[model samples]
Target chain A: MHTATHSGALMAETTSTKDAEFGAWMTARQPALLRTAYLLTGDHHSAEDLVQTTLAKVYLSWDKVQKREVIDGYARRVLVNENNSVWRRAWKRRELVSDQLPERTGRHDSYDEGGSADLWAHVATLPRKQRAVIVLRYYEELSEAETAEVLGISVGTVKSQASRALATLRATAHDRLGLGEEER
Target chain B: MNHDHDDLAAQLGRQMRHEVEGLDRAPLSLADVKGRATRIRRRRAALTGAGTAAVLAIVVPMAMLAGQFTNAGDDVGPATDPPSVSPGPTEPPDQGPVVGVGESLDTADLPIGDVPAVTWLENGSVLHTADGENIRLEGTYEDVVRYDDGWLGIGGGLAVLLDADGAETGESWVTARNLATGQGGDVVLFVADGELRLHDNVDGETTVLRDGMPDTAEMIGVDDEDTAAYNLVGPQGEPFAALNRDGEETIPDPGTDAYVLNDVTEAGWVSAITQLMDDGTCSRTVAPNGDVAGETCELMFDRFSPDQRHVIAGPAYADGYGAGQLAVLPVDFTDGDDPVLELLQSGARDATLMSWGWEDDDHILVVTATPVDGSTDMTWQLVRIGLDGTVENAATPVRGDEFAFPFALTS
Candidate 1:
């Protein structure tokens, strides 16, 4: 009976320590994760919700995430996957709002919200797969391989998506940005 | 071909930075995040259990029948099927070093349109351009701040605000230091005399938003609602301050000599940060009611990201001047006692980073200057550094040689 009691106490201690460690990691890492989510979602509320969901999944598989060095990468992978799923569902339910500007339309004459509005608007017009490539490649600065791993796609797919996205931006915004026609 | 893309990337980066700068969303507390996450975990666990039970019911009966037939013929097979041999561990695939070839200038003749930029010239004048039209403001202004519609600068013995087209907004005031803007569209904050004051220029009326505060009170910043944050010395000489839409509420005094208020986040929480003499540099987010929410320690906090989640710091100060090291780290770093920093480019002597800005959530634009070998003048370079340690020289946002310094790259 004494041995069983001692073993029970040990189990409790181990569980407590594990919880503490997880809590500490979450406390320190949540803000960075939320910021990345905000960039991905372009809104604060949705970003927070996405991070919370990702963290919950990470918690469930904490034991499986054996390598401490890859925890950040693991979390990023979960985030990208979750974002892709959400984007798919959102696309399915998307309605055509008449007032919404077309992809080819340039900025209005009085629209000077800042230089960012045009760029961001153009980015917003991109397909989810293409946007994800641009964000992970240029914004998050992830390499093609890391971006592929995060999105569960091939490196070749990342490269192609990025190329297509850039071409579309150039075709649409070339005149608006006032760039010369000379090919580099 | 890649040069055009790089320029496009740089333009996109600037836009992302602009959007992030004025973001004023309240930060999530540790308890709040955990509570929501736990609820999600429980819901997911329930769904997973249901699915597992359904799968198990179907598999068990089938497996039992198969096992009986297989057992009858077990003697015909090698005794235990010779325990399956495991393969040796293999090396993980790596993509190797980051590509750095696309640093060349793009002289593409961009169409003549509104180029939103604030440019400083060699002759001590400011050039404001909107839609390819340039208007030059005469005077020697040291620096300029950009807003959505216009820019604020000091020139000709007065503070000035110019529209995107270079026309003066007819609002001018005495020059001040530490300029900041809040949600009050054209409203701006600056230090006057020994006190902090706000000058609102919206609707052609200039009004003083706040005045007559203690000289010891230094304005940290304002939030989305035009709320101001100040760090002031208490009556007992300890650090006491408050963040409020208006400074009517009583300021709370933590009564600790080691820490003082450094920043006020979007959620109105006060950040109690350490002083230089403290054992280690750190910042802790605390509730308005004086409850500590989270704490983070790091070597230094040169500047915080627009979202306030990460910080750019360096150990150059430790070497007493010349460029030593620069890195980006999460504000709440927790890899043992030592701060975990992703080191960017380093080892250049006598180089000083003058200004840095976020290009995106995980990318930074850093501007550095180094003294010329023979002359007192300094050469400036713009660099784009990523959290993954990808470093590349970036083309300046402004076009032409008329204006040398880039003040702001606007929409």
Candidate 2:
């Protein structure tokens, strides 16, 4: 939405026309947003929900992010924050029980054959924070600094978490894919 | 980067693409997203408007008033006799001007307000107004509740007891997380970090009701008998545990399939039972024996009235859709599934009902936007609405440095 504020003014005048631009931008960027969300959350349904929620938030604060460059970053931050909050609630609710087992494994079954699938599965096995860092850095191709900003953590913490995640993924690949063990 | 790790990154990126490729491109449309965003924007606008109004009404006036009083001596007025109300069945007479800032609060008549009431300023300074006099309690407290004699302020991981004079009598570092006071007794159920500590002021004693409660266990409320209801989580922290008032060691039944439990009443409990329909939320008021007392097609059943004769249920929506209005539902409604709902307040073009608290048996104190004419910027005002739909301004719009909520009323 195009909401222009006069200098030293308390209220910003909002225009409905800005939504058209925002809508167009969203339509173009949604695929990339969906991919990031999908990697962040392993489920297709959760990915859609996260994207929709993030878009809604971005649309609400569209005025503040009118500067073209900041919109994607804002949306990513919202997505990551929303995901973190959901994860916190799930953890508090104890819904992260890996042993209870899901009722349907059909959704997870599609990506089970290739080495790509093996690597993805290993990525999924990592803790939420580490997985987020790995996805933002390697998949989203965001810088370590950008990843830190997105996750609201220190650059050093992001480095350590990504390093730890990569090591775990490598070890898992050796055990599951029968890859030759490499020197650390 | 190492070649192995670089290969793994490439593989991961390919897998992520494959994952996205398998998914549906459009689960929901941009139009649908825009609509949802519009609704969310409305809510945000309402909040912002309300906040702006609060700053204008409270903050600006307080600064001016403080400036005027700086030259004068800082002397608090003497205490006066408490307002007397004969024991009978009638609503308490409107206590004259509860708490206000700036010109709204005529400092010459300071402390000349109703008694047995507690109000706090923006800076967390609590005013215990009684007998037409006020006692200023200096300190920041996260939460405060009125007890039999004084008020109990809980904050900084400690629970402190202040007497009628707003003077601290007792302080304990019990990690007082949440406190629930029941109807009559001097008993208070204090849920610590992971333990249930029951404190009785009558005997001046404190005892542990149950220790080693699951860290995830949340204390909801306590009854007159000191039986506390907790929203228990499963071993995996799934909100699948039953809403049962039990001792610490007693295992909560996981047999109930209710997804979320709402309020606990002496009669039974209300829960949002998952349904296999359009708007999958179904609310049911059930008895303690798991007997359904009444069921409704409502998204939420928020709070039960003090008398428990009615429930403060939601924004008048047909099949779970709308900005929603706060309504009062009769506790015993079996005449039909769709009964006449008593709407407490409605959302205006610029203002919306933010939240509400039961001030007394007959009055529901609502915090909502005060609609300003011809302007989108609205102010927040605490309104007390009677069961008969009578609206009265409960608190004087105090102008202060920052907006503060009338968190709780102790009377």
Candidate 3:
């Protein structure tokens, strides 16, 4: 009976330590991690899914990850890769979304709410790379090099992507920008 | 009037901040965290189980014999199969790495308008699967964008992309075959072997961002696409002049009088070029970094007139807060060329400006968010300002939890 009791205590101790470690990682990365998830899903619903999955995955390896300072980077990479994987096999379970703009970018343009949605909608039409670039760049405020490191690519690619992304955004923006137009 | 555009941009910036401020923060959930770990473990067990492996051995041969993993049931990822490094069959050497090419995920069949199927080569080079079922775009680049032009840009027109086998890839607002797509969607840039290439996505072509190499690789700028106007801040603010397509680099000429300083924040520098037509001298106020342990105050300015007489200095703050600086500066400048420098607005803590719009060069329509004490509630208030320094506050019907940060302003 005493042995069983002692063993039970050991188990509880292990659980607590694991819990503590998980909490530490969570505290450090919760803000940045959630942001990545939101950018990936483009909506809060799926972003929640992505972040949750990442946390859960990281939690399982709490003890192992606690030994490293790169836990935050590991968690973020996991979140992004997982989100991309979901879309990779999305062919089978693809849901058709409207060509209309994503109405839920949090706020609308009353002067041209109609145009804001259209811009985002066109943004939605962009390739994953383009979408990811805009989100990481504007929303998260990461640098081209940092973003490249996160996304894992060359800096040249970042430039090319920006050019294309801006061109696309410029097309939608021309009507709304109300400025001296420049010829392409 | 250059102020007209600045006013318009300021309004858009305010709105974007508001949208960001409106995002709902998810409540913390440790139980949820515990649950995820449990799920991943169980899946790993299932994948390694005797029954699963035995079935896989037989299924592989059968599928190959039958022409493919033809069944849609394969959609369920092997319980243990997530987060695995999926380097595609043909991966480009890391020498000229593709920007943001991390773990390979399943490709999507997005409608790439005019292009054929777009397949990210196992290599860094992207494969264009044209209508003829051809996979090309290989051997076309080496050290992609080596010291020259390695990245490709497809401007505003629709670009159709296909995979190696004619699968529809997603379209691009623009594609930075390498650079711009990373952190700053507004600027595609790369810094390798001491060379820095910053390109703007103003159109399909990639233009040099700021010339010169930054001490660090942090790019701080956002795609305010509407203006073909976005702001960028580089690490250490080592000023590099603009790069023209003629392959010329504008060396950073800190004219003792006019120079760029990026020491305010590690996020790089903030350069707002308000009006191109302004004969006015523009200015930026930067508070020295590391000097403020808590919150030392500073200001930023955008000069648009001459003689330091007409500059748009700010009530802006340079602190790290959820909403961009509250003490946003109102434009106050002179009409001279004698290196204009003036104090604008002091940074405020409790103030939140959601969006700002301009009725004219003089008037500003500011959208602001004010947090209520003890109420856990935030309010969005609209205020207007004039060149004559007249201020008016108005309430709008625009209020909700969905409003996001960096709410954009419109003219």
Candidate 4:
């Protein structure tokens, strides 16, 4: 009975330590996660919701994730999957409308000054999967293999999707600017 | 990787970083995440238990059947293999009603006229209809400016003039920036090394419009009266100015707030967003004489209609990551009158407004993702929305994971 009580106390202490570690990690990484989520969803409210859900999933799998160096990757995978699922679920349920308007944040310094706005606009027009690849590979600076793993696709697919996405962006840019044929 | 590809990748990274820079972290707490985690754990546990029970029930029956089959197999004519049947192709699931405002009609129901348009970037090629022929423009260009006699193809920091047949005319400008057509495309205006110059196609001469201009100055458009409008970005803010034939500057009073120029009309009217506060932003148009032509709150004017009678706008400071509501407001409006003439709500959730352009003086063509009633795949449809609240599908839907419609026109 004494050994059982001691074991119980030790287990509780270990759980508490795990919780503390996860809380610290969440606080430290929340901003970066939110930025990626915003890029994926394009709305502040939706991005916040996505990040919250992603962190919760991470917490539930903390035991497995804490032992690996791919915690960020795991969280990112959850984020991408959650975003895809949210859109699909919205379509299935036909409840896409949100009652509250998305909250507006302050304009970042040098916004749209460097012609990045046009590029970003074109990025928004990309398909969801292709867009995800671009976000992971370009915005997050993930390698092709890493992007493939995060998206659960083969590396060859990652390469093709990234290529197609870039091509589309170039073509769209020309079209937007009323430019003709791409220089060979 | 190619140089252009590398440049694009770098630009994309910079742009994405710029988008989220200075954005405040969301107010989420570890406690909130933990609470949600507990619920998720409980639900998953319940599901696991039920799944285990279901597996056991199936496994017990299968085990008994296997034992009986093993005992009787030798006498059962080698247990004649059950007729193997391959599963047929699974049909796409139904997605439900098409989401949009008002009645939805097929593209055939609309009135037909000559829809002379161009669709570009199909496998690195551009196709346009000219004189009833589908002409493909040769070579890839960074920017193209259409003129009455020829096209100006800008790439690799050089602006090469191309004839109507997409052939180079040997007229080119080096290091050109912000090239735009003025005086009904009879001339092209551009800034080169802080000098605003005009190239007259009729005279085959290049003349300097104004010197000592800021490098950030970009020619927006030119009015019929030989007036050119341009905007400059400085530390203070972005302020738009107009220059007439006599080289006089008409700098509009942008009030005391920073403003971003959206579009400038051929009539020298400027539409811009100002007062970008935390609450919201405001959009207004300034006339050539520094008068406030029209103004609207909580919305940013995207572009002027082809006739310049109305402006299509969306929510100000909107991330525009998804489909949202769009509104059309008359360019000429009183202070107290309602600015919105019509509001087009994106009816379905997850439907994104991909590309939009003025179809004609009375209609606007918007390409949006339409959910397939039962499948995960979405179809792109060209929607024609009229000023009088009429919406119709202007083209047959094409199934794809990406937006496939390529005939997006500049508004």
lDDT of 3 by residue, A1-184 (tens): 9999999999999999778867876866676676667655666667777788888887876667645777776776567656644432111111111111222211112236555544555555565555666666655656778766666544545555554555545444665554235533
Interface quality of candidate 2 as DockQ: 0.15
User: DockQ values for all predictions?
Assistant: 0.07, 0.15, 0.09, 0.20
Q: Considering DockQ, where higher is better, how would the candidates rank from best to worst?
A: 4, 2, 3, 1
Overlapping backbone residue pairs in candidate 2 total: 15
DockQ of candidate 3?
0.09
Q: Give the per-residue lDDT digits (tens) of candidate 4, residues A1-184.
A: 9999999999999889888988888888889999999898887887888898899999888887645577877899989877755443212111111111122222111123345677797787665677888899999999999988887655655776777777677666665744334443
TM-scores vs. true structure, each candidate: 0.39, 0.48, 0.35, 0.49
The C-alpha local distance difference test score for the whole of candidate 4 amounts to 0.57
Which candidate has the highest TM-score of all? 4
Per model, state how many residue pairs clash: 13, 15, 112, 13
Candidate 3 lDDT over residue span B1-411, tens digit each: 134333333433343344455355654588887786786675455433422342233222222211111122333222212222222224433332121211111112111122212112212133322122333433222112111222332212212233333233452232221222322233444443334444454443544433444332332222222111122223322222232223443322223222222111112122331111101112232211111011111333422211111223332222111223222232221122221222122333243543333333333444454444443344444444333333344323233321222122211
When 1 and 4 are scored with TM-score, the better candidate is 4
Q: Which candidate should be chosen as best, given lDDT against the real structure?
A: 4
lDDT of 4 by residue, B71-131 (tens): 3232322112221221111342244222233233233333333343433222113534323
Instruction: Report the C-alpha displacement of residue A8, candidate 4, in angstroms.
Output: 45
Q: Which consecutive 10 residues in model 4 chain B have the weakest lDDT in total?
A: B78-87
Ranking, TM-score, top scorer first: 4, 2, 1, 3
Considering the two chains of model 4, state its CAPRI-style docking category.
incorrect
Off by over 4 Å in 3: A1-8, A24-32, A67-69, A89-118, A175-180, B1-18, B49-411
Q: What is the lDDT of residue B36 in candidate 4?
A: 74
- Interface RMSD score of each model: 21.4, 12.8, 18.7, 13.0
The per-residue C-alpha lDDT of model 3 at residue B17 equals 40
